[model samples]
Target: MNKKTVKDFFDNLAKDWDSFEQPDSAVIEKILDYADIQIGCSVLDIACGTGILFPYYLKRNPLSITAVDLSEKMCAQAEKKCTDKRIKIICADILDTHTVTDKAERCLVFNAFPHLGNAKDAVQALCRHLVPGGILTVAHSESRESINNRHKEKAFSVSEPLPSASDLADIFSEYLEIIHVFEDESVYIVSGRM
Candidate 1:
């Protein structure tokens, strides 16, 4: 999809994002376990739709979090939900060379990876921002079939398909040390260290 198309679609939905989904505690646990998050770690929450991950991250007490999305309304809504001093919200395309760099120890692409114009190049760029041994994760609270079907159900801006497990394994292994891959009826998580 065109970058602006994706931005506008989400910006329009930002106000009602909570009506779309809430972070599932079980899925959040799986994500944290896969990433091996610890207290005081720096986190980059990419495409952090309406800051759904904010409360969970705060519970882990991260040192800092840079929540980013291409939608202005999305970021504004996130800023409103997240009152913590550690989180910084940015509305920018992650593919931009200089959008955010060398800042986070853990980079999370939650429920928003497939929309990328180019997933491989985008993954490489996100990996560039991590500290050595940092983690990069792409996750969803729903299964592969469910996510894809849901996107298809609506005339949404997400035009690209979420990669298969093997495809994602290749992408993750290409940019960072492959850690774990999980795909079940309700969730999917692919993570690695940078």
Candidate 2:
């Protein structure tokens, strides 16, 4: 999907996005556990809609967080919820060059991977900001089937079907060492080290 379409779709839904998509706490903990986010680590959150994962990332006590997204309204919503000096909300596309000036110890693409246009290209762009030995993770609180079915039912032009966890692992492997690839009825996650 094109950038404008994705941006507009998210922007239109920003106000009620949280109510529509509630994340499971246990699944979130599982994702964060697999993410291996250490205290004082720098983090990059891609497609950070309404900062859904911000509070969770904050709970890990990261030194800094750079949240990037394409929708202006979504970023605005995120900004309203974020008061921590450690967090910097940027309204921009992650696929763009120089979007994030600093490198991060952990880069998370949570609950938003399918909206990215090309899986390989998105992973390539995200890895550029990861410090050496840093990890990059793509995760979803919901199962692949559930997410895909929701998108299909919504008939959204901007949303693409999520790939299998193993396929995503292959994509991550092209740039970084594969760390984990797991999927089940509850969640989907793929992590790698740069």
Candidate 3:
């Protein structure tokens, strides 16, 4: 989807985004567990709609966090939810590498990868920002097959099919080391070290 479409989609849902349907708590917990965020590392939360994962990450006391989204309203809501001084919210597309380059110790693309349209570009962008040995975790609220089947049933055209855990590992293998890949309930966590 284009920026306007993404913006409009999230803007209209900003207020109720958090309460919208989501992965189970167990799945969320599993994803967070795989994050392995340290005490003082910089983090970039891409497409962090409504800041659902901010509080969880904040509890780990990160040195700093930059939460980015294509929707201004969603970013505003996240800013409000993330009261920590260490947090900075940006209303911008995550695919814009120049907008957020070499700034994070870790990057998270949670429940937002499929919507990216260009998953490879998104993965490369995250790889570029991450420090050497840094971590990049990409996850979805559902399995690849489940997501793909949903898209097919709905007759929606994705920019590219959702990649399986092995698919992601192979794509980023040149730049990152696979750390973990598993599904918890419907959520699938793909962790790698850059």
Candidate 1 structure quality by residue, lDDT tens digits, 76-189? 888888899988888888778968544788888888887775778878888877899899988887888877787787735665778776689898897788888888888788
Per-residue lDDT for 162 in model 3?
A: 76
TM-score of predicted structure 1: 0.94
Model 2 alpha-carbon drift over 4 Å, by segment: none
Q: Model 3, poorest ten-residue lDDT window?
A: 151-160
Clashing pairs in 1: none
What are the models' TM-scores? 0.94, 0.96, 0.88
Using TM-score as the measure, name the better of candidate 1 and candidate 3: 1
Q: Per-residue lDDT for 1-194 in model 3, tens only?
A: 57676678678888887786554766766787787777989998888888888778887888998888888998888878877888888888778756854468888888777767776677887788788888899888787787777766752543357788887877777678889877644778888898
Comparing 1 with 2 on TM-score, the higher-scoring candidate is: 2
- The C-alpha RMSD in Å for every predicted model, in order, reads 1.4, 1.1, 2.2
- Once superposed on the true structure, which residue ranges of model 3 sit more than 4 Å away at CA? 151-160
C-alpha displacement of 29 in model 3, angstroms?
2.5
**What are the per-residue Cα lDDT tens digits for candidate 2 across 36-124?**
97799999988999998888888999999999889999999999989899999889888898575588899989989989878888889
On TM-score, the leading prediction is 2
Candidate structures ordered by TM-score, highest first: 2, 1, 3
Tally clashes: model 3: 0
